[model samples]
Target: MFIVMVAPECAPVAKAGGLGDVVFGLSHELEIRGHAVEIVLPKYAGMRYEDVWDLQPSHHDLWVPWYDGTVHCTVWFGYVHGRKCFFIEPHSQDNFFGRERMYGYDDDALRYAFFCKAALEYLAASGKRPEVVHCHDWHTGLLPVLLYEQYAQVLGDQRVCYTIHNFCHQGLTSPEVLWATRLGRVDHFLAQDRLGDDTHHGAVNPMKGGVVYANFVTTVSDTHAAEARYGDSACGLGHTLHRYQDKFGGVLNGVDYDVWNPETDPYIPAPYSASTIERKYLNKEALRERFMLRKSWSPLVAYVGRVDEQKGMHLVHHALFRTLAAGGQFVLMGQEQKHNGINGHFQHLKDHLNNNPDSHLELSYQEELAHLVLAGADLLVVPSLFEPCGLIPLMAMRYGTVPVVRATGGMRDTVFDRDHGEHADDRRNGYVFQHTDNQAIDSALQRAFGLWTDYPEDFRSLMLNGMRADHSWHRPADHYLDIYEHIRHK
Candidate 1:
């Protein structure tokens, strides 16, 4: 099987979030299974050239159609972590991909539009017809649209499988941008079931267009798939997603153990496994010293993510205060986004926690601290209002840290409470709260703390069960392979 993955990010090279991890992990796993995989991404100015091995020129002086004109680009080829990677660089005159940041440009829609067009042109010039064109998120959503509408004959019989990593960001742009694809008039996509969303009247929804054209649509988890089809979580694309219910599904995102395993992690000071779980306290002590927290035997509760409301930041604050009141230390590792007003509140909270004897908050992204927090903390809290597929809880569990998460999306599918599940003794790995409120979070936390302090044996069982659990790409890779084969055969 030949798979061409088009996405905005890839791990250990040019990553903005978990999308990169998913792209790199799935592609590498597929290649390891004897399938040829090639990734196409934008050559952002900030991308480290040193990370790309055997870098060389592949295509120079490539031209792609933009709005009413042609944009010249140069394509670079290299290998990142054993997978063939292609970087499309738009000409300096266009400046589509010339910015230092990977995203958040005023002309982002145009930037990715050029990328989609250039990717297809590169494939056509190279005469490469992949069996599966796997496009991730809205960044590459228009690839399916372009392939189905404009370059159908040139691209040959290629089936596109579009994965919606996050539906909230639908890539809405002015309908005028569609001219760059040379597909047709804006009226062609103005239909209710197509690119037109009721909220944004004059805007084009690239994700809705992709869902309408792609052979298969997948979300990050089964619960998320269900939510998008029937609930408001789809962000107004529910009509399209539900219309294609037969073709829509999901696969839970997998954790890359090569980067997160406690036994072999290079970031954490003390790497301890389930058998030698007693040594985990050394990491806890190191984290306390590093964060300048009080040295005590009390449990350490931790949170690692963005400081935003979507992640249930309010609930986290509520839980953290409660944790501190209950004679426990709290360690938070996160970065605040400036545009979000709630971040200012988080900054004030960070300042207050910094002055406390039993709490510490670092307001920046430190990958090493993230690893150490997961390894050192006794409990990891993920109180998300709506999570597609959170990796933090899984990574924390792998480090023998029990998770206390709200029951939603991947957290609901992955974490099981020892007191609630049918086979509690054998299946439970973490604490799960149902409601998305402070009371729910407090309940889960108190349960975790009680398990740790009163029932030491059950707490140890939960930790060891989580450490031995399987969150790797082995099963997810097979699931994706099945989806690819199904789409190809259909």
Candidate 2:
């Protein structure tokens, strides 16, 4: 299968969110399954040449909106994880992706609009008309629109599949965007709702436009797919998804085994497996030492990811107060993003725990240190308000650490409840909370704490079970191939 993945982020090159993890992980898994999979992402200023392999050149045209000047970007290619990926070298001002953050730039809409144009231009220039061009998130949402309006005329049957990692990011642009592309046949009809038609709240919605144009629409998770059609989760864009429900579906993201392997992890103090469960304790001790804490603790619960409110940071923060009060220790290894628009309640938790000694909150972010914490921690926390498909819990489980997560989206599909246990300590994978309240999180924590405090034997067995579980992308990638095949045929 000659399939191509078009996303804005990729691992070891340009990454900030789970989207990078999805691209690199899924591409590798698909390639391993004997599928010719390639990824297309922007070559941000942060790219490292040494991280990429088999470098090659492919020309592309990037049109600058404000000026009539043409920015001819040199499209570079390198193989990562046995999958070829394309990077557009801006060559122009390079100010488009000069900043660190992936989103929220002053002219991100313009930058991404240029990128979408470059992607289409590159596809035609490179002469690689793939069977399927799977576009992820709004970053590459315009690909479907371009394919249908322009490219489809030339390349008759190149099926396009646009996967929405988050529908919240609707790439809205105006008629100026069309002019910026040098597209002569600009239709005023496209400015409407169905075909980039209606201007959204005065502007336009590019993500929604892709939804209406793309042959198929896939969210990150099934639960979120249904919820997105009509709920607060949609961020006021659920109606578009509901209208296109026949074409919309969900495809869960997968964790890359190579990136999160316990056997050869350079970050952990000592690598151990399910058979050698005793070695995991050394990692726990080392993690405590790294954080400058006492080695002897009841049960060390850890949270290691973005400190955003959507990740249920407040619930974890609230849980910490009770966790310490109940004679347990809590460790956090991620920084919070300041200045929230509508969802910024986690700041309250941070403010409340400023002078508090019991709550050990470290305001930092380190990948190496995170790997150590995952290997060492007795329990991992994932209290997301609504996760499309989280990878932290899956990473935690890989290192023999039990995951206590909120029951929603991928969590529901991945993490089994306590009742599924074959033994008293049989449900050792960790705890689960369904509701998005403080009580629900606390209830799950209590369950995890009780098992660690009283049932030492059961806890060890559970950790072993978690370590033994295979959350790798191999199986999930095969599932993705199935989806791809279906998408291609449809």
What lDDT does each candidate get?
Answer: 0.86, 0.74
Give the per-residue lDDT digits (tens) of candidate 2, residues 412-441. 766765544443444347788888889988
Q: Put down candidate 1 lDDT per residue, 298-394, tens digits, no spaces.
A: 8999999878777898888898899989999888877676478887887888777657989988877666678899989999999989999988888
lDDT for model 1 comes to 0.86
TM-score of 2: 0.89
Q: Candidate 1, 310: how far from true, in Å?
A: 1.2
As for candidate 2, its clashing pairs are 171-206, 191-197, 192-197, 192-198, 193-197, 193-198
Best by lDDT: 1
How displaced is residue 228 in candidate 2, in Å?
2.0
Model 1, 390: alpha-carbon shift in Å?
A: 1.7
Model 2 regions more than 4 Å off: 48-50, 53-67, 173-175, 182-199, 341-360, 419-428
For model 1 the local lDDT of residue 368 reads: 64
